[model samples]
Target: MIELRSQQGETVDLICRRAYGRETAENLAAVLDLNRGLAALGPVLPTGTLVRLPDPPADPPRVAVVRLWD
Candidate 1:
């Protein structure tokens, strides 16, 4: 999970565009909504609200540029 700080109070779509550069923020929001389960709520990401990306699967990093602290 990344604690992304919004320099400007931008909407969720803008946030995703800035962070992930993917135009599927709405799909992510929908998934979040369904996972809410028992209680239903409004949009997950609201402007400057801090959110989490949940536990990412234990997959190898796309670009593992690990260098020893020489």
Candidate 2:
């Protein structure tokens, strides 16, 4: 599983984009159904808190899974 870390004021969308690519924020948001307030992302994720970056999924299936942040 990938570890999602927040960077002062980092949003769910920003996490996705940074972990994957520039165009992945929105897509990842859609996958998580989190349009706003991504602070509830994990047990360790706090608002504007610094966290780790989840690893990007490999090619083939192209699935953006929130499980990575576990």
Name the candidate that leads on lDDT: 2
What are the clash counts of all predictions, listed in order? 0, 6
TM-score of 1: 0.40
lDDT of 2 by residue, 1-70 (tens): 3455477656666666676665454456453543244445653346555444434556624567677575
lDDT of 2 at 44: 36
lDDT of 1 by residue, 33-52 (tens): 53453113243443455544
Best by TM-score: 2
- What lDDT is reached at residue 2 by model 1? 49
Query: Model 1 Cα displacement at 31 (Å)?
Result: 7.8
lDDT of 1: 0.48
Clashing pairs in 2: 2-68, 5-51, 5-52, 6-50, 6-51, 9-48
